[model samples]
Target: MASDAGVPDPETQSLDADELAFSDEGIEATLSPADPESDIAAIFDALFLISRLAQHNFPARIDIHTFAYLACLMSIYSGQPANEWGYSFSAVPPTLPYSPTLDGAIDRLVETDYLKTSKSTDVTNLAEFELTPEGERELGFFSTLSLLSRRLQFLDASTSAAVFTSSAAVVNSLANEPQLAAATHLNSSRQLLTESSTARLYDEFEALSQAIGKTDVNLILPASMYVSYLQSVMRATAEEATGEAVENA
Candidate 1:
């Protein structure tokens, strides 16, 4: 039941007859293993957190190119070669051409304000880039472990009915698209699903949950969709509440 990391494997755990697990003390066991995609996202989040936590350790400037190239830097920092990380540049979109250098990608990142050249550094010819303050703050949102865990617990709670409604919304939206709903072949469905980010995310999460031994599709799909719904609701509520509080001042 234990993984090489010595942690109990989520897939090996038994659920209660009622469809969820709880400790004898009535505490819920909500641990879940992130899928490969989620794991990569978490890695980026953690890297951003680590960089900010030890801001002084980083040079006044850092470098970033494309996502794949940046991922290579992250791998190197983790004492790995880029090839060992198994990154695919084509994963982004239209197939990327092989370039001996990443100068083009680096230029784009610099123009986008995600990375900025260091003002204090005196190296004239060398182009160094660093995470702009805005970039750090954006990545930092995903870096909050407490928030992520809290959201996971909410998804696994018995009272989580919101996710079902969210999943239904996804299904309803897809059904309303006559072109997609009428597709008889798998390729058509795949293309339509891939075109919509929401549809794609739900599909991926549902697959992950099922692969990890979730027997009830009804439960898993809803839970997967609910996470996205909760994020939107939480963000909107926070903005509204903060605005009202400011107006009343």
Candidate 2:
């Protein structure tokens, strides 16, 4: 069920802590604190989260691209705060990537039976899409993957919490050993760069991993290599047939 806020009602929401049981331990500390700087990020997170849930749950079909586009347009029309759309929308016309532009991707999705288009309720508007049975099966797989990802995130948060616990323990231990207090820099110089470097590296690694995963390796992998692999299998089959013919003779 949807709320007046235009997002799903939390009570009716399917993907919740009770339904999925993603690890909750030590994640409380890692939860992001809301502030003005994070407004745009929060908007996107909300938009995508609701979009995925809507696609998976709602009877009426909506693709992510269409939903995002319309939502942005409507938000502007309804006088949503400037900060919500500012940083990303400054450009007059944004560049969409090659091969699978929004239109192209939607077309391909429909062609592959992942989605099906139907006439809109209002004739003035364009058609909307709904998931096919195949699409729902794919969505089930996606949900499974999302559950695993949440578990991993929770595990990571728990490890970070453990580190904080260990650090506190060390600080307490140092308090007992007054001699070591002078040796430690905990109260004095802060090495911000060293502390933040690991986090930056992790962010880079995650970004690279995501980029690599999204890449169409079929476009990059040599066609000749695939041909050679198939040819070797065919050659082995031909040799086996020859041996069988000779035995029969």
Question: For residue 200, what is the lDDT in candidate 1?
Answer: 38
Model 1 Cα lDDT, one tens digit per residue, 85-193: 2222211112111121233334444576655665545562244445777667655664454433322221222113223333223322322222232342222322221
State the lDDT of candidate 2 residue by residue for 47-122, as single tens digits.
2323343333331222232233223222222222222321121111111101112343445556787766555456
* Model 1 worst lDDT run, 10 consecutive residues: 21-30
Q: Which residue segments of model 1 deviate by more than 4 Å?
A: 1-54, 57-106, 120-125, 142-249
Best model per lDDT: 1
| RMSD (CA, Å), each prediction | 20.5, 25.4
lDDT of each: 0.33, 0.30
Estimated TM-score per prediction? Answer: 0.24, 0.24
Clashing pairs in 1: 62-129
Our tally of clashes for model 1 stands at: 1
